[model samples]
Target: ISSLRDRITTLNSRPALDPIRIGLFGSSGAGKSTVLNTILGKHFFLPVSGMHTCTSCQVHVSVCKSRYYEAKIFLLSHEEWKEEVKNLLMLVESRHKNDETDNDLEHAIKALKAIYGEGAEEKSYEDLMKTVPEVTIPPSRVITLKKTEAQDLASELDPYIRNQDGVVNSSPQREQMQLWPLIKQVQVTLPPSDLVPEGVIFVDIPGTGDANKKRDEMWKESILQCTSIWIVADVERAIGARAHEIMVQEAINACQVGKCSDITFVVTKMDKIEVEEYVRNHQGAMGNITQHTAILETKRDLKIRKTRALKEKMMLRLPSDAEVLQKQDMVFTVSAKEYWNFTVLTREETEIPKLRDHIRKLYLDMKRNQLHDYLQEILGVFSLVQAYHSTQLSQDPPMRQEELQSCLSGKIEALKAVTTLCFSQMDGLLLKGVQSARNTHKRNIEKILM
Candidate 1:
C-alpha cells in the first residue's frame, strides 16, 4: 500500500488543467441537444431554442451533469425549411404584388380608390370580394417539381461525392486516423476543459444551416476553431438523405480547415433507429468501413440494405482511405439516454459496458500528445550530430571546430524554446497530467435494431 501510494501520488500530483474543448456540429435532429443533456446527465437544455430544441452559441457555461467548461452551439437546419421556404415565397409574392400596384399614380391601387371617388377603393374591393368571396381562399397547391429535374440536380452533385481520394480500404489505414476516436470520446463537458485550462469551446452548430456558398464558408469557419469535432450522423437517416450528403461534405471540409486535426463520428439515436444493427456480421469490421458496409449489403433485410449502401457508399466514401486516419482521430456511436448511472456518472453518460469501452478507447486516442514524437525527433537529431563527430577526423580541427560550434549554437537555441514552453515555473511543478479513466460498459444493441 505504501508503494502504491507513492506511485499514485506521483501521477496524481497535477490538477487537470488543459480543458478538452469539443465542438459538436451536425444536421438538425442529429441529436446534438440530446447528447448534451446526456452529458449533463439531465435535461439541462430545455431552453435550446429553435423549433427542434437546438442550442444557439451559448458560451462558457457549467454543465448540469457535473461542473466543468461547457458551451452549446446552435445552428439552423433544413428542418427549418418549412418556415424559411414559406417566408421566401411570401416575400416574393408580396414584392410581386407591390410591383404591380406601382404601375402609375392614376391606375395605382390607391389611385383607383380616388378614381372611384372617396371610399371607392373599399367599395371596389368589396365588390370584388362579392364576386370572389374573400371568406376563405383555397390552399395553394404545392407546385410539384419534376422528378427528372431532381435527378438532374443530383447527377450534377454526384461527382463531388464520388471522389475516392481518401476513402478507407485497409485496416492500417483506419488505424492511422486520429479523429475517429474523438467521436467515441465521452465528453462529460462539451469542451474537454474539465481537466485542462486549454479546453475546447463547442459551437454546437448544425451543418444544415448553410444554404449557400457564403453560409457554407461560415460553417467551415466555425468548425475550424474546434480542437475536436463530433460529427453527428443520425442512426435513422445516417447519411442517406440528399441533405446529409451536403453534411458529409461539410465534415470533410471541417477536416480540411485544420481546426483541431481530429474528428469524431457521433452515430446518434441508435436506440430508436433500426437499419444499422441487423448487421450481425461485417467482414470489413476486420478490414474497414467500406468493406464491411459492402458485407452489410448482402444482408437479407431491405432497410439494412439502405443502411449498408449509405454506410458503405456514402457514409465512409471520404474515409475510404485517407479519412480512416482521420477516423483514428475520433468517432463515436451514441444514443440518447435510456439508463442512468446514479453513482458518480450521469445517466446520459452512462451506457452499456461495450459502448462505454468504445468511448474510452476514443478518449485515450484523443488525449494523445506529441511529446513522444517530439522527444524522438530531438534524440534522433542529437545522435546524428554526435555520430558525425565520431566519424570526422580531428586533424581538420580548425574547420570542424567552427562547424561544430555553429551547429551547437543552433541546437542550443531550439532547446531554449522547448525549455521555455515546458512550464517549469508553475507551482509544484505540476503542469503535465492528462485525465485517464477507463469506463467499462457492455450491452447488446440488438433490441435497438429490432
Candidate 2:
C-alpha cells in the first residue's frame, strides 16, 4: 500500500506542461534575427550589425496573454556576476601573456566595455569587481509596455537586450548601466498573431561558440530543451566548413541527448545573388530564359543543389542512429528581406510562410501527443484504483485474502503489458505513416521543380 501511495504521489507531482520551444541558432552574421522577425510577422528583434551579436543570451519570444507587451529580464546573481567577471579577466590576461589569437580577447573586451564604460579591460580584476555592484544588481528585471506599438516595444527593449552599438541611448542612466551584458536571458511576450501559434515559444539562441563557459553551458541546456531546432546560415555560405562544424559538431552533440525531435537547415538571403554573374556561369542551365525567370530559376536550382549537398554531408558525419537528417523538407532557403520588400521574390518564393506553417504544425502535434499521454496516465490510475476497490468488495475476501492480493498483482502486470503493447503498436503505425508521407512529399516537390 505504501508503494502504491508513492506511485500515486509521483504521478500527482508531475510538472505542468511547458510550451514547445523551437530553438533558432546561427553565427553572428547568419541572419538569425531577421529570420525570427519575419516569422513573427513584425520587426520585433533588432538586427545586429555584421561585426557583433546582439543576442548575448537566449531570447524567448511567445504570444502574450495580456494587452500590454511584457518583458521579463532574468539577471545573474551577484556571486554569478562576480565569477563571470573573473573568467573574462582571466581570458584577457591570458591573451596578453601568451600573445594568442585575439578572438577570445576581443569578445572579452567587448563584454567588459558593454558592462563598464570604454577602456574597461585595462582595469585590474579588483577594480572591476568594485564596479559590479553599480550595474550587476539591477533594481528591477522586468519591463512592460502599456498597449504600445511594435516599434515602441522594440525601442524599450533595445538597451536591455541589444549589444552596445554606436547608437546612443536616450537615457544616460541606461547607457551608464548596460543591462544586456549582465542579463541571463530575456523573455518577451507579444500580442497574439496568426504567425505564432498558441503555446509555442521561439528561442533565438546565440552561437554556441562563446568565450564564456557559463554561456556555452546555457546554450547546450537550451538546445536540449527544444522540440525543434532551426539552424540558420547565409545562403552563400551555408555549405562552408564553419557552418558544417556548428551543425554536425556542436548542435548535434546536444540534440543527441534527446528532447530535440526536428532539425531544419535554413539558408537566408536568397535574394542577394548577382543574377548576371549566376547566368554567365550557368549559361547551359539558364538557356533561353528571361531575366526575371532566370533569377527565380537560379534560386531554385541553388536551393536544390545545396539541399542535396547538405544531406550528403549529414549522412557522412551523422551517426547511423540519427533521425534529424531522415525527415523530409529539412532544408529551407529563405529571403526574409524579399519577403517584406517584395523586390525580387514573391511571398511564397521567400519560403517564410511555409516555415511558419511548419512551426505551427509542430506545436499542434506536440499538444495532441500531450493530451493523449495525459489521458493514458489518467486511465492507468483509474485502473489501479478500480482493481483495489474490486478486490476489497469481494464477498469471499476473508478466506481468499491471499488470492485477492495475487489477483491484484496479476491485474497490475496485465495493465503494464497492455500499455506497453499499445505504445509499441502506435509507434509502428506512426513510423509507417510518416515514411509514406515523406515519399509522397518528395515526389510532389520533384514534380513541381520539373
Instruction: TM-score each candidate.
Output: 0.40, 0.76
Residue 244 alpha-carbon offset, candidate 1, angstroms:
2.1
Per-candidate RMSD vs. true structure? 26.3, 13.4
Which portions of model 2 miss their true places by more than 4 Å? 1-16, 99-101, 109-136, 139-147, 165-177, 208-218, 249-255, 287-292, 302-326, 398-450
What C-alpha lDDT, on a 0 to 100 scale, does residue 221 get in candidate 1?
55
List per-prediction Cα lDDT, in the order shown.
0.41, 0.73
Q: Give model 2's TM-score versus the native structure.
A: 0.76
